[model samples]
Target: MQYQLRVSGNLYKELQQHLFPGDGKEAVAVALCGRYERDGISILLVHELMLIPHKECYRAEDVVCWKTETILPFLEKASKKDMAILKIHSHPGGFPAFSDVDDESDKDLFSSVFGWCESDSVHGSAVMLPEGRIFGRVITPKLESFPFDKVSVAGDEIKVWEHNTSSYSPDDFAVRTAQAFGEGTYSKLRRLKVGVVGCSGTGSPTIEQLKRLGIGELVLIDPDEVEHKNLNRILNTTREDANLRRLKTEVLSSHIRETGLGTKVVAYPFNLYDSPEALQELITCDIIFGCVDSVDGRHLISQLTNFYLIPYFDQGVKLDADGKGGIDKVSGTVHFIQPGSSSLLSRGQYTRQILFDECLRRQDPVEYSKRLKAGYVHNADVDRPAVISINMQISSMAINEFLNRLHSFKNEPARNYAQVSMDYSDGSICNVAEDDLPVDDYQVMWAGRGDLSTFLRMIELSAVKV
Candidate 1:
């Protein structure tokens, strides 16, 4: 794949910081996000990625960029068929020429790019000059730099260089991201199966976003419907959608398929603790997200994820409404539950009491049946009607958790707290994985038939000397 990257406004500032030495980076750099939008697409870069042993510097020096250390690990994680198109850099001076040192570096750099990034494909690199001039170069398998001086960057994507001689131009950022991802990260996820538990509130948006991210198979769990109250949070559902008695999973499945997302949605109306059925879906998903209402559900899902070796991202929101119901205090939490690496639970986020209580409540028939009748067992989870903004926030927050656990693009974004809150009314952000954990003896009692001696005696008595 020929790689191109579009420049976003946010990205422009980041590159300048790394090259020009702003307050941004005292250290390393990184490529944070790869996304698409109507304006164009590009990768989001931030100053946080710099975790190398070398001292970070803004001026030209003997020390290599910390961002450079990040590449090998990324490539090592990728397969041979995938390659990076270019190492986007900046020259604050607006100097068009590659410094003599840059020329020497290009040969060595492109050699590595060909051995890795350009394997069975073509790739390029680019520089953004401080004066706003941009340059790109094509690389051969042998590490020769064919400076495409004729190239131009029109936003995030690059218009093809028309000159036989080196030239330059600005290209579209979105187009470049698409091409880069096609040859690299996105293609690797083509066969993945993702599971979303609870398709209301955050879950609804999460399902939509996952499908958009190109997951091939999704197991959507929920059993609720469209209620006038829920209109506040669920995505795609309108007032017109309310009268139809829409099932959350079924509706979300329809939305995903109708959009040509190419993702297969398996609608599970059953609750997450429903044993055999829940286990089946858990075994099938590559990743799982918890967007359910109950603490019991999270613990159940967390346990399943560990046993199955599937990564799980769980998110929740707590609000303290004021008397007017207009505004008050709110808290949102996102956690990455890895199979074994001292999870959020280890940090005191959730405890055994919360998990067991939830389990008992769900296991009880009266409560389960009641939620079922109210459609709580089925559709979205909210004490009251929900709104769109909160739902999307939860979904995005969950997705963000997923990325933080999976990618090391930047030093983790700062947390206002491990908890997120807009509580002038009062709020806190917390990283509570260390609170309390479940010592689940999910083990079944071995109540096998008592010793057979008594049965033999009874049999003999009944035999009547036979």
Candidate 2:
């Protein structure tokens, strides 16, 4: 089976710091991870990482040898969760390949660790060059091995190293899109597997644009049914459908299939974070458009994008009311979250406190209600007014941003606008206010941080069994 390893930027940064401390000596890094299965391929997501002190090593300058005391504990911890283990060490000599010492080490280590833990879970070893490029491989208990097809690190910018494939030609249908962004852009769109979370105001419109642009496949996630009030903003929704309480995803799924555009659609009428089975489908997507409203929902997408090494575009709309029944503040934000770049958290779009409050509400309505009544916590707007026009405007901008990313059609660098915020009342849009990508040496923080050490507090109880 083919394998791919994803490391979160935080862990990657940790690895770099530990292995290349200014002291200038090789170090050891170990990560305990779980598997994401897609089409029989196992994608390892490193959840927790630890740096073993080099003093635990008993080798000379050019070689690395870890003490059994340090190695046994990591293996035992990994075996407890049936998780895979990745052993990594740096190569200051600029060799990306495993050295003879590494081969001898793995032959002895991989062979004994499994016996010690009685684990059939896959274990692998990797070599990281001084420049931070990683070449990883999966090893069998029998000592057989295969190189990892690619490695991904997710942070403010997503970095990927996939096996090469020939470029494709755009079809006749993409003529207009090709004219606008060059033919090369169309090829990128066709090979993409995009995910749209939430099929309401913003999500529906975002989906509408992606389909017409000749995207190859889509995964739609929404746990809502059409309501009478939603008809005004949700595209492709009808009166009859609203009256029947038809699932929003089903409505969109039917439309895409009817177009016969060869765009595959998988609709899940469930919250993305609450459905592990559905989350699996998302691992295959190249990009995700987060169009949900809740802070909790956004939090999940923000983390998922990093772990899966998938770029994400998250758009949100907010309206503030003036007690006097007049227009007050109308604003929305379109943030293009690339892996290995500055993240939403770093941007301050949503805070840890907001996520905490939202989770409390979802888990316990009574306590949340009591807290709200006592003014112990602030609540988000439950019935914010929404208009199709503004939704369309923001959605269009987000889609345009997506195009800009793949084609860089604009004269200025795309990074210039890491985030674009608009004030509808003021009729102004600008991306300069927000901080751009950070230059931290650890840009790879969660570049590929996959499944959490434990199911996220809110997601654990909610993940529906397949």
Per-candidate Cα lDDT values, in order, are 0.50, 0.76
Predicted structure with the largest lDDT when compared to the true one: 2
State every prediction's TM-score relative to the real structure: 0.49, 0.74
- In model 1, which runs have C-alpha deviations exceeding 4 angstroms? 1-182, 343-345, 365-385, 412-466
lDDT of 1 by residue, 1-466 (tens): 1222333222344555655453222223333222111122111111112223325434343223434544776555222324233555555445565666566766766566556543433345556555555566655676555554233221111122223333222123223423534423343234456888888788888887777666668898876788777877777787867888778777778888888746787888776544345445554455778887676677667655543335567777666556686646555666655443334454456666555444545557677557657755442234643556766776786665554333323354422113332222343333432123332222101011111222212232232111
Q: Please estimate how well model 2 matches the true structure, expressed as its whole-model Cα lDDT.
A: 0.76
Residue-pair clash count for candidate 2: 26
List, residue by residue over 359-448, the lDDT tens digit for candidate 2. 889878899889889987778747787889989999999998888767676777666767888998898998842244453223245445
| Candidate 2 residue runs with Cα over 4 Å from true position | 7-34, 37-39, 46-118, 123-137, 146-167, 179-184, 323-325, 338-346, 351-353, 410-414, 432-449, 457-466
